[model samples]
Target: MAQPSLSMIVEGMIKADSPKPEDGWTLGWDVVVSYSEEEINKNLASRWEKHRDEMIKEIETQMTEERRPGESSDEEDERPTCDIKLELGAPRIQFVSATTSPTVNLLLPVRKGSSKWSDKQKTSILPENSYQICLKNIPLGTVKGNYEEIQDKNRSGKLPNPTTGEGECRFENRVPDHDPSKFEVSWVVLDFSMKEGDLNVQGQMAPGCELDNVEDGKTKVRLARGLKVVKSAAEAFFVGTRETKFSPVFNVLRHALVTVKNKELPQQVGGSRNLTPKKFRMASLKGSEVKPILSLFIHVVDGVDEGESRDLQTRWGGLWLNTKEDVMAPIPSTHTASILIHPKLIYKDVLSRSLASESNKGWRFKQLVGVEGGGIALHAALQCEFRMPSIRLQFDKGSGRIQVTVDDWSKDLKELPATIHLHQRAMDERPVISVNWKFSTETRRTNSRSEKVHPALDVYKEVTGDITRWKTTFKLAQDVPMKTNSTDYDITLEPDMGKLSQCWEITEEEGETDVWDKIKNFFRVAWLSNDEVFKDLVVESKESMRKMIPGFKLGEMGLGFFLTTNLLNPGAKVIRIDKDVGFRAPGNLLLVGHVIQGTDEVKSGKV
Candidate 1:
């Protein structure tokens, strides 16, 4: 299929265990991040060691308070010497595909916290001996289990003698319940929608438990009645964990995406800038049946008028594929994607706005010709007013460069109004001499009745007779070499001043002059054309032209808007840009690049 004039397509695959259905999975999506049992336990152990002292003190204080005033407090004395250990088995996550909900299960073994005190004195307890502490039977509504006591020789208050037997006591570890359903907690169902300029998400609990009863022949387990209450309590736990542990991360991601989509470009007074997805779908490709591919179509529209009518489907018609054959075509293996840009977006939307900005229109200067007493002080003021010029970009496949041509420089270039004044001193307000001149395209004039007097002719009429009419013409054309860099999508076009070819032609019709007078006028024209004199004038003219219309660094011109508005992702850095595809393609400009993900934080704000 042909590429679009303006659009972006991103294609990638998700490796799944089962083959994707032809119709595709459209109910919802699931994302699971898993950690191994050893890794989770290692992290927990480190944290537990750091706060073990504080936790033991808190537990002892609580246990002491729970004892009645008259009850025996002998068991509390051994609590201070007990050692606590926490063990958690690997966790499992279950995602309900139909409802797009999540359920988490964790295994927690119960062990006895304390053992009965023997008749032996407390002083006999060896400092090297360790005791296991068990938490109370908290009555977990979802899972049921019994605490088991540790069997060891130390229970008889006699530490094993190093010379007689093994120096350490042995305690058997309790086996935890492995039934996943007993420890499962289901989260609320969440729904998401993107519309207008906002991302909206809403979550609610299921009306009732779907797995309530087990029916066998004419008998029902009747366990669902109690299970319903337990499920409600689990839902509350899920909500608490989501709010405390996951909501902040989710909010940050949503804010970042929405901010980039709705960001407004600078100097966008009459139009709007928007970044939105055109299409997003999940489907299986030909060779990768088990690996479903995700195709996301995104587009950027900048400086579009508020109420303008735009048919995006027609404008981007070439990007769409209609049949299975076209959709199943082998995707590009390279890690790159193209960005097609229309000419209007560059010339009208970007360059025109930058040139017409108030900050870059005109300049002023003052200089003294000589240092001698009050040597001809000269001051000049110039201003430019111009219409945007038409430009063409031709990509050369061999050189990998774009030939930028400006066919008729005079057509769009307006005359520059320059006013110069001569003063004897810096403090003088009124100048001794003042001249008003205009630099522009050449002209012609004749004394014939049919020909009108040129504006420039009037300026010289006081010195030369009206009968002595003159004609002048200028021809200007330029071809600049533009180099494209893929790194930042920058296009560099700086034309050499010497290569900007121009020609000036001047002729005069001396209507009624004698031989000697005509001879003098001829010498005057010859003097003006001398190589030494003309070279200086041409050099000065080129200098002024450079100031009037400066060269362009289009890379910044295109991306400056996004940077200023904080639209681009802070965590992604452009590593390499690929313009070869664009040069080979039929579009005016195409750009592709690779970006490396960083750990930068995304700032949030309304665009």
Candidate 2:
């Protein structure tokens, strides 16, 4: 009650500027306050002067009674004291962009847990609870293209440009059309911050650091101790003639920042904020890729080998593909006139479809042209402009069927065209050209069910001619779908060869036709008894690779047909026949179709 000795009155004082949980920098505890014990004694000296003598004598006697020979006491404790300590709080988090020329400003959301503080002031206090940070703003970035940078003024708005010394590598004197192994990069910088009151730090503050490196000329940074950055999409690193043509670096980085943040992330906190932080999700690691389908320009000559067996598989002629771009010396003069002309061949739709699945965002088809001398060029005309829902090509040797897997399951029919070229000279050899037709044994079904499904093969002559001028023998299968209900069909003979062409429909139409013509044409009869007076009849073959073609068909219901044709002098020996499947189910059913298109090769001799 006697004011307890003045020496015992003072305790400790709290330091003001403590770091918050959201702050990016570190805080070390070393703050201190000085207490003036000597000063206080001097200021009160006059007032206690009279008793000073007695006080000194009594103090000296008590001090002497408690003193050891060489011990030094804490003088301030015996006199007066003032203490200093930082107010406890959490550290804040900040965003650090890998690139110097960062183009965008973004805010990462922080998931803070319930604070164990006694009051509001204590809530912002440091070392209270650790919070998780996440961001869900814009796309990861663009590839191979330039982009503008964006900044947010409210939070560390300073944008980073091409950071110095982050020298972009460029390969000098590389091969022609060769891309540099390295890349030029520009990035936008972002700084994240937090006020002391907003953070509740807990657990040992995590240690972190980052470093950058270059591989094959491209710049890449490594983080030693921090969250791994993930991209939402696949990014290309190398961009010479191969790898990727675009700036995949930015794509990967942007996707990492945006996509990863939007999804649920893993939580590292507990208690009132027990809601676990969502896990960070990443795109598949297989990455984006594409494959090329090949096209070969070949030339064939008869009489190269005249030994073995088999007519179609004979050992007479040899085939030559233009491995070199420029034309080779024309076949030796001797073989020139006798040269059975057949040039160019393609492995139709022969690339894996799965490779196109992941990179469907910008799916494209390309023709791989690898010359004998290593010269390569890509033709866009051969590229597939869009991705199918499903990417599968099916061919069964036993069934003699080909099925192309489509992405859309609703439609069972896919229309494809077949076009063959006949050299102008080949048409001059034979007067009356004959066409031989063949069919595959495989039957098509839809959704695993083969009920009444008759594959149809309907052929229409391309030349326009008088209906009565043409004579031909053909059967209308009852299973072929048509607008009309007819059983027998045939062609009639006309006087001139031109007349036969008149009855030929030249327009490119799909298997289905209008109701009027469908019914009208179905009943037409084939004229197989007419006299043959034509010579050297020829149809030219296409010079380019076989592209999808268009055509029309005449059909009768309840029947299906497959047709093959042989000219007087068959241009190419074998008409590589294959089936095309338009639809497929997991089990036994497959909706099959055909991609009949002209080959780039032209046949020079009679069929």
lDDT of each: 0.25, 0.18
User: In model 2, how many backbone clashes occur?
Assistant: 106
- Per-residue lDDT over 287-330 for candidate 1, one digit per residue giving the tens place of the 0 to 100 score: 22111111112222232221111332221221223322223221
Residue pairs in candidate 1 whose N, alpha carbon or C atoms collide under 3 angstroms: 113-133, 113-134, 486-577
In model 2, the worst 10-residue window by lDDT is: 55-64
Model 2: per-residue Cα lDDT at residue 357: 38
lDDT of 1: 0.25
What's the distance in Å from true for residue 112, model 2? 26
Per-residue alpha-carbon lDDT of candidate 2 for residues 553-588, written as tens digits (9 for 90 to 100): 211112111100111011111112122211111110
Judge candidate 1 at residue 81 and give its lDDT.
Answer: 24
Could you estimate the TM-score for every candidate? 0.28, 0.15
RMSD of each: 24.9, 37.0
